[model samples]
Target: MRVLIWKDGENHLIFNMLPGSGPDYNSVVELSLGQALIAGGGFSSWTYRSGFDVSLPVYSPMAAQLDSQQIAVQDRPWVVISSQINIHPEYTQELAHLAQEHSELLVLEACPSMQSSNYSMRCRGDEVYHYPQVLKRAKFCLVIRGARLGQPSLMDAMAAGCIPVMCADSLVMPFEDVIDWKRAAIFILEENLNSLMEVLSSVSDEHVSEMQVQGSWLYQSYFSSINAVTQTTLEILNDRVFAQRARTFEDWNLPPNPLAARSPLFLQLTAPRSQGFTAVILTYDRVESLFLLIQKLAKVPSLNKILIVWNNQRKSPPHSSMIPKIDKPLKIIKTTANKLSNRFYPYEEIETEAILTIDDDILMLTADELEFGYEVWREFPDRIVGFPSRTHVWDNVTMHWKYESEWTNQISMVLTGAAFHHKYWSYLYTTAMPGNIKEWVDQHMNCEDIAMNFLVANVTQKAPIKVTPRKKFKCPECTNTEMLSADLNHMMERSQCIDRFSAIYGYMPLQTVEFRADPVLYKDTFPEKLKRFNDIGSL
Candidate 1:
């Protein structure tokens, strides 16, 4: 194995390790650079302490240049250990012992001091240029802690597509929140130093192959350059801004009820079954599911009206007989726009205090669930309340939201069912849609539910609440075909929608919302005392 070292400042000198220099020892070089303090001591600068310190800053450009000269894994050495001056001598002794015990392992130990038992005497001036080549040929690179963490070796190993064996216990890996280091690197405790060979031997060839692949991915995603650090810093700043805004909202102490609650007859007018709340269902060709949903909703005595927005492209409407004959008023409104984006079109005509949006395919939502959701909306009328909520934003890699099962107050989006106050709906309806909404809808990327969630959260200065139901509701059509397909184009469009929302609002919607446990429902149904105010005849 050969090691390359470059000294950048005065003489642009390069150092190289010669082959057969010794039996069990390699050549390691050290180069020092200057340090400085900048920006009123907020950030302190440091000098290059290791060969990797100088190499990593230019790793991408240099690696690209060396990519064409890549060597197969079978051609590389069994192991490579480039030790710095600060590495404890005990670690060196262990390496020497391991090399002698396993001569077939072909360990290459490089150090500035050539003091080991099997010391390599030759050191060429151009080894720095071949560092990438050396790394490409090695199966594993030893990463040991020195003055600070062994980040340079870890990073260099990854950049060269070598599996890193990290011997630093306290070292903090970058972007731990997003990157799973265990999958990409081997971590060995100090106490396990004697068993180092055993540990390496225990790893299956398949696992090593996986680690090599993941190490390369990890380097490109995070350790390649300063971009990862900048992204992480920006994320922290975004969180701080969100926290400040949340604190401001906490201080305001706005009443839970919307402005409409101040009316003298507000209690009677907004009571369940008094036409206080309207159930809005959006349908697109699923007439059977639509009829079933209407039937279930009609059984709930508290609902005053059920408005079905027919968004199917078919020219002919379903026969009136297909619609369930329910006691509550059922009005089917036809729309020229067949897109799901038109789900909010009925918001303009809603005179009720609040509106409940349900999907046409929801099969098992009970009357108690609707009443429970309605009660939650009344208490937090400033927020959009819903079930089947997701707390995390969609991961671009996995294309799935994190923490999907748990209910969160700071929900990014809610699915299937959502309840909103009429005043809030009016605000959204009045707000002009983004100029690109048409294009978004045409591309099948228009998410009315997520858009509404963002709107309510932005306007109300509060995160939307996911109202937990007394009994879980089931939907046969829960997993849509487009979602199941996971088409890259569709995913890109969804990301674009979120980006557009953030660009227009001056803040990312996902960061602004706060996350908390699901709000508790005090009672399963609307209180019996409020039934006297019901103007519609009971079921």
Candidate 2:
């Protein structure tokens, strides 16, 4: 009858009786099956018959002249090996003598080998032999179970209190966790056989005692055949379930199996992009210019913000309703005539690289000319420059704006009545004068823009301001133009209003700055701000 018992679900694979006991009954019949199963992913299982008559095993301690408790030497030591190792008879005799000389132990297993006639069991002195009896008394068992058939002998040695010393290169026997290999086993690789004597000579008595305690622990824990069978079963079954679940989940979540699937695009256009310039149209009751400037600014690409500072006490602006769609921030500052400067001045608080200062009286710059002004500032960051009037149609050649330079020479202050790059207030704050020229403009004059040009040029080392052609339609305020033409007296009065500042600062020019490579390089250029617009195009 054949009996197959599985202990732990799928781990321990053991087989009991073979067929009829004939001449074909080989001692290694079940061993061959165990080997095949081990090679095919299964744990080892040995079988012993329940009712077979067994010889009584003897475990008597061998008689010796030396004390068993005390090691042969103090620090010097030795190892015990079974007689199964392949060594010549003459070499074995030599091994015995050397062990005695070094005070090392050579506790040999007293079994006669079934093969190989080269070595005999005969040895030197009082043969300090290791039989089954000696094994129970010994502290260590050096097991080298390399052959297919001799593992049972090694286990038998382990059952007797002798700690087995198998090489690390050998297959891990079952119940390995129970053995404290680090303490009890002295593992040597096959390649280091030539130096085995040196290893044996270095073993100590304390080391041997530690090994004995560890060996006893291993016997109680791992070497039990029943426990080994139970542990192996769980390992095989858990591995199979985990692999199956992993494959099933991965298949469910895998992306659309179509060969040409496209990935979603995640492009972001978050930042505010501009040609990076701003236009501010200044107004005082003249909503026409404000409307016209907004219309033209709307068409200018890359304008960041448009601001309309309307100096009208009686009215609020209809800017959002009147202007075309633009992708820049729009704001309006409206105030009475008396609070004109105060209300509009706060808009200057808007932080930017440059500011466009516009005059309500005249308009000449076109949409194209306004953008070109920004390009000029970006390119030539060192000096202030204004747009030039377009086609001589809006030209102000008849108007002469004269002022004196620092050296007292008369220079024209006239620029095309359009736009100018604004300067940072910090430049004025750090100045020896301690204020933007505008602060003093309302005090001593109405020409705040003109005074600022002089202050910037003076402090910045005579950098010339360049004027470009304006694209907006240039027109003068009717009230101011009529007054100037009607009376030389009124014209002189307005001119005298700015004369006090001129006397204090020197002959001020309308155009004191020249275009440097880039006005921004002057290090004090403010950002251009555009807050609001109107539908009227350029006025």
Candidate 3:
């Protein structure tokens, strides 16, 4: 990427892109590069240049065009703003009469070419000055898209709270991603120049104000500082990588019969051709939170089956617990304290389109939230999965969890254990769980989920962590208590235990790995956090 700094002399900065990394990181790298350019005497001589005037910070051609006396004074109260500078002989008389009849804002027609008594004049094109300054002084800008599409002009106009009366089809528009255009700018078709007067007249101050707010919001959301482009770039440079992989449930010997006769579970629960996914929660003693999770998970629109793999708890059944038994088949798999059963049994039982491995202590999540996740997973299957962080509330906290959308370009390493693709679990099962139980069991420690993620990261050289958009969840048991006290203590303990165990034997087989130590928090304080807490008190 080449950046040209326009000062008294032109300074060029050439940036070389690294192999394997694409334009995704360009925005982030530019921040550092811009600082370097500034520090290298790039703007040293620019302080006292020819056209420098600090007081006249904002330069609006509209203001200049509207305040000059180059057009004929008009009788009507309305003002007609035009982009044309050349006052041709044919239209000069009409323009003068119109100005004489109403307020007219005309572009400067160079010397005595077309003089009028009733108008204000301003020059167009290059003499208008830079965008940031120009936009601040103008009520509205006549945007000729030839300047730059999706460039800083439109953004600046929006930022400065100026209304942009622009041509519909321009050289460049920031229509690259998604934007609600009606809420942003007033787009005029060149062919509809006759109606332009009417359009301008119809625009109310209130409408303009609303549009300004909407435009500003859009700009800040997608184009401002600390945006997705910036975040994604930072992730790449920081050695955090995210990738999405897709596979049919059939590929993993899971359910949702693409072939009709295969799954009894699907046949009983869903309509023919109805797509579904199962979430098999792996749990032990956290019964209260587990029941809460079941209630939340029940709200997910696409969930076909809910299976609770109760490690070494044959005495408990799904009906006896706080979790209700719905029309969908809910089962509790009881097993002895065999380490392998805790790790593998849930995966084995979740024979559906996709198997979401949730911890027992989650008590956050409604049907709509899960549906959002499913939709995101469908759209960006290559990017794995997404969910909002369940850590903190937005009102009390300063920053938000940035990853709660159907699509987000922002990348973070903090949400690995919360939500992920079912394919990832399968990958771990195949690659990391190939050996006998004794070989990998030592790999299991406190916070096995996080440890597994680290294991996957080491093996794959890609970050297994990400932020889920707005959906937040935490342990339900943590309510009315300091989050960092008992809740954080349990979490930290498990994490430290995992670290200690990994330090000892290095790697072990899946069967011997103990997943019981992984502490699942059960709160849904944040929208992204789906609180799935089992009724521990009842159990």
Candidate 4:
């Protein structure tokens, strides 16, 4: 809707301007001009005329070009920008020189005549579309001031899954009330422009990865589309008007699942898993293997308590004469039913926050492996840390969740059959999980581990961590089927469980990660005395 006018020598043209400058208009789109209907924000501040809360700032969603291709988190050493000389000439010029020195720092030029450096380049005309792709590879996108107050690069960088480093003299971020941008973006004052490199360099790799994920999450949750933006604005207004029915800060920020809980870092950090872990072994008449497992577990230095869930109503409890005489205390609680779901029943005897939910037949795991896995779990208390890992893939032909037990680099689940998980999960599995999921596990007498994996990942929005190598949790001296995990029907049943569980939850929450935790000096050319977990079994 743009028209070009050719100037005549002595003629004057009359120009008439109207609000919105379109077919029909009812209100002005200016934030500063109106007393009543001025709700327009230039991509940042939402200044309500009759605002209910003065503390929370509302953001009018601004539309930006979106590139929907998702990429995994890669190795990044980036401090990037797309700068215009006309807007911030001094800043861009200084940044260009800085980029020449640090190969990691990149500066893209908006001015056509600007020359390309080893790390900096100019994007002209149609090349602007590729900006998001450039951002996708970067760890941080530098946001300098534009011609206006707020810049579009902030939104663009976030959409590209790049953390935005705000570098304006005075900057106010969008949706400051609801979205926690501080968790995602790094803010820098204009006076400390020279310290930008030092500040960015100080940020750890783990923190950078977290910020990138958070930035992308914030964008997708609030500003991906026009519909999302419009709806969010309306929701904000609704919340303001009806204060009694308003949601909490977590409700606005996090994905739906245990929104009230604090971050696991603060909550579980002080919980003394070091006082030792309580081993909860679920058994069904496998007395021989169960005793062997209990004997091995009794040797663990961190063994505090052992509770054997004797899930066999048809059979009588083994005589105390058959039980292994171990140093650690062992109590067998006979369950009312022989359900697989009995493994996760929260009992009063379990006193530790760290729970080793290992199967009775899993005797292949060494004491060193178990202790090392426990140490790893202490670091990531919210995740499932264990040996045997399983992955879920989408089958286009079948159009359902397909479970794969192959040895791949990536995995979505760490089977609780031999994993170390938080005791909090037992409570969640028994009560908080989706509709009739536990009952299904009971009826099938399988997939209780799968159900537990879902509940933990859903609560944390994080992937389960796989530790050391895998023996597929193979039990050499098992009287029963190998926990049904190695069987074809069991794999298929687990896959069906994933689909059914996803339907109940209304979304897939299991995150897939390409990683496995090994001890720091594991398998390296170090002295035998130096290596702690030397007995860690890996295939």
lDDT per model vs. reference: 0.55, 0.43, 0.42, 0.71
TM-score of each: 0.42, 0.35, 0.34, 0.55
Best by lDDT: 4
Residue by residue across 1-539, what tens digits does model 4's lDDT show? 11122233112211111223223331234332212222233322333233422121122232254566545556544555544334567776677777777877776655354444322334634354244557776778887765554555666677877788887554445555566777898988876766778898899878987887777777787767656665666677678768877877887776644454334445444345557888989888888898899889987888899999888899987988889898888898999988887778788898877889888888888898898888888888888888888899999999999988888998999888888877778888888778999888899988888898888887778888888875556787753454565578877888898999999999998899898888888779899799888887767
> Candidate 1's residue-wise lDDT over 1-539, tens digit each?
11123222332323221211223221222224223111010010232222122222112333433342334456666654443334667876776677778753433444444555322231222232234446676777777755444334555577777787877665444444235677877889876776777888788777877777767765665446556534433443344447543323222222234432232223332344445578888776777777888888886666878888887766556888777798877777888767665666645566777778887766665665566667666666656666656554656786544333344445566553545444545445435555554446545735565566666656555666655432244455555552322455655555566666666667655533554333243333666555432222111
TM-score, candidate 1, is 0.42
- Stretches off by above 4 angstroms in model 1 are 1-274, 346-349, 393-410, 442-445, 469-474, 477-492, 510-539
1 versus 3: better TM-score goes to: 1
Candidate 4 residue pairs in clash (backbone atoms < 3 Å): none
- Candidate 4: list runs displaced more than 4 Å: 1-273, 479-483
Better of 3 and 4 by lDDT: 4
Which has the higher lDDT value, candidate number 1 or candidate number 4?
A: 4
Better of 1 and 3 by lDDT: 1
What is the Å distance of residue 60 in model 1 from its true position?
Answer: 73
The alpha-carbon root-mean-square deviation between model 2 and the true structure, to one decimal in Å, is 28.3
Off by over 4 Å in 3: 1-274, 318-323, 338-346, 380-417, 430-445, 455-460, 464-472, 477-539
